[model samples]
Target: MTTPLKILISGQHGQVSRELQQRLGDLGELVVLGRGQLDLSHPEQIRQQVRAVRPDLIINAAAHTAVDQAENEPELAFAINARAPGIFAEEAQALGVPLIHYSTDYVFDGRKDTPYVEDDEPNPLGVYGQSKLAGERAIREVQGQHLILRTSWVYASHGKNFLLTMQRLLQERPELRVVADQIGAPTWAGSIANSTRALIERWLAGRAGAWGTYHLSAQGETSWFGFAQAIGEHLLANGKPCAVLQAIPASAYPTPAPRPLNSRLDCSRLAREWGVTQPDWHSALRECLAEQG
Candidate 1:
């Protein structure tokens, strides 16, 4: 009898991590560590945890994801985002294990008229993006067997995301203004987890592609306004009151960290290489809501 694979996942309570826990349970014995257990801001702690786990695979689901907050705390952001990933890569390499690190579409400035592919040059508009980009580069510099998965607008039924926030606020407030200019897929955490499982299964079956960065988001795109409108529609269908949503440019909602005007990522490489695809944003949102019910 073969021993089950030992999978080490960081960020136990994150949107993606929570979904991963549900999806990947049958595949292996999971060793999941959240911020409380393994504070990612400390490089030594990261190295020690990975060394202690010495698992078959390392999935880094943790990140300092507060975009505007990162502007005030660049050191903490880089410590967790940039330095921690590098440490994981180093530890994973030492243990002869593959590392899977999540990245963000914020790495790009969102200037391109079309969707961004994997090779697009990144020009981050704020500290958050710059730090995440640094993490991507850190993993690459390690030159280990790793998959840097870049996704955007991540949400889940059970986390602090736009979907849940909109669900509540839309019912409470009479009117809400959402940014309409910025665009990206509202990728559900469950979809990301399912796709990740497919990728892992392919790799385990010896059909893996090149170990590098891949864009893993939902199929289509929409702005924040469109997403809010969809959420309102869902609430109304469920016999709940929703607010009147007003479409506004990103300028109307000034944040400390500037968001990309176009956050669409082309995920063809993931499909071509690993036969992993994603549901369209609307379809995924519907599915996520159904799961919530």
Candidate 2:
């Protein structure tokens, strides 16, 4: 007659939040808090909510995830991404609960044409990246029982992400112009959630896991243009509307935010440290695409 583990998860309606709740339901009692219950913008709410729940584990699935929008709303982004999670860590430490948090590949500047490891120097170019980097540093400063997973290109069936956007654009347009300069592994929210579960299971199995950062992107890499091409191919073959042509190159388009040219992440340490291996990007993408089928 063992009591079920009570896990308090933030970001009640986020992409990863939804996936994590569904996957971890069997392993614990999950209590989700939307912005109303625990807004990441307010540090006090994070502190108070974790203290009140007294959960065995705290999974912070919430984040200021809008990349381009963060540029105009630096204060809002910092409050939610940088400062709030630190407050969550403080309270989780007081309760002696493990905290699981997520980060992004934007922490890097994309100068090097190689996969970035957790130890790679972060040179964020935008407010979103800078704020997320701040949160990562703050979490490490606390030195509590915590795991920060840095991932990229997260999408799910429910959220407005790359997948849905591509689907819509391909259906509506005759031609597409995507930037090829930016590169990253397209990690599915479902896969990230499932991987988190496995990591937690291993932690509970008396495994010696490190409380540090890990590159949690999916296997393989693709430029934004290539990613869109792949999506278009899938949709066109599946009787869905798709662009007749997709042009690829960086000079073809530009944005207010200069994106990282290389979002490739090295998962060797992630595997060595967490004892987990992520599926290839194509495989994970195929699975998620089928999830909509």
Candidate 3:
């Protein structure tokens, strides 16, 4: 009989991690660790936990994702986003297992007018993006078997994300002004988890693609305003109070960390390489909301 795979995942409570727990249960024994069990800020703790678990695969889902907040605490961000991922790669390499790490589109400065491909030069505009870029480099430096999946505009039904926040505020407020200039795919966490499962299944079945970086996000693109407008439409369809959304330029909204005007990532590489693709942002959003209902 084939032994079930022992998968070790970090960030038990994160958006993607939560969905992964739900989606990957039938595949194997999932050892999902939260902050209390695996403090990513501590490199030794990460090493100890990975060594103790000795899993067949390691998924590093935890990240210091506070884009603006990271500016004030660069050390904490680097420790969690940069150093920890390298350590995970080291341990995974030691165990001779594949490592799957999530990255962000923020690595790009958003200067490009078109979608970003895998070979695109990363020019991070803030600390969070810089830290994430560092993490990617660290994993690559190990030269271990890894898949660095870079995603953009991640959200879920249960987590602290734009979807939940907008759902709450749209009902409570009469009008809301959302930035319209910044563009990206509002990728659902459930979609990311499902894609990850598919990728893992392919690898286990000996149909794995080239082990390297790939962009994993929903198809199509929209601004934050467009996403919020879509959310308002959903609320109105369900007979809930909806807010009046105003589209404003990115300059209108000054943030501690500047967001890219174009956060579009070319996920065609992932589709071509792994035979995996995601639903468009609108369809994915509908599926996610249906889950909440």
Which candidate gets the maximum lDDT versus the true structure? 3
Against the reference, the lDDT scores of all candidates come to 0.94, 0.87, 0.95
Worst 10 residues of 2 by lDDT: 245-254
* lDDT of model number 3: 0.95
| Residue range 191-237, candidate 2, lDDT tens digits | 99999999888777768478888889899988877788888889878
Q: Which residue ranges in model 1 land beyond 4 Å of their true spot?
A: 1-3
Q: lDDT of model 2 at residue 272?
A: 88
Q: How far is each candidate from the true structure, as Cα RMSD in Å?
A: 1.1, 1.5, 0.9
Which pairs clash inside model 1? Answer: none
RMSD in angstroms, candidate 3? 0.9
By TM-score rank, best first, the candidates go 3, 1, 2
Residue-level lDDT of model 1, residues 144-169, one tens digit each, is: 99999999999999979999999999
Model 3: ten consecutive residues of lowest lDDT:
1-10
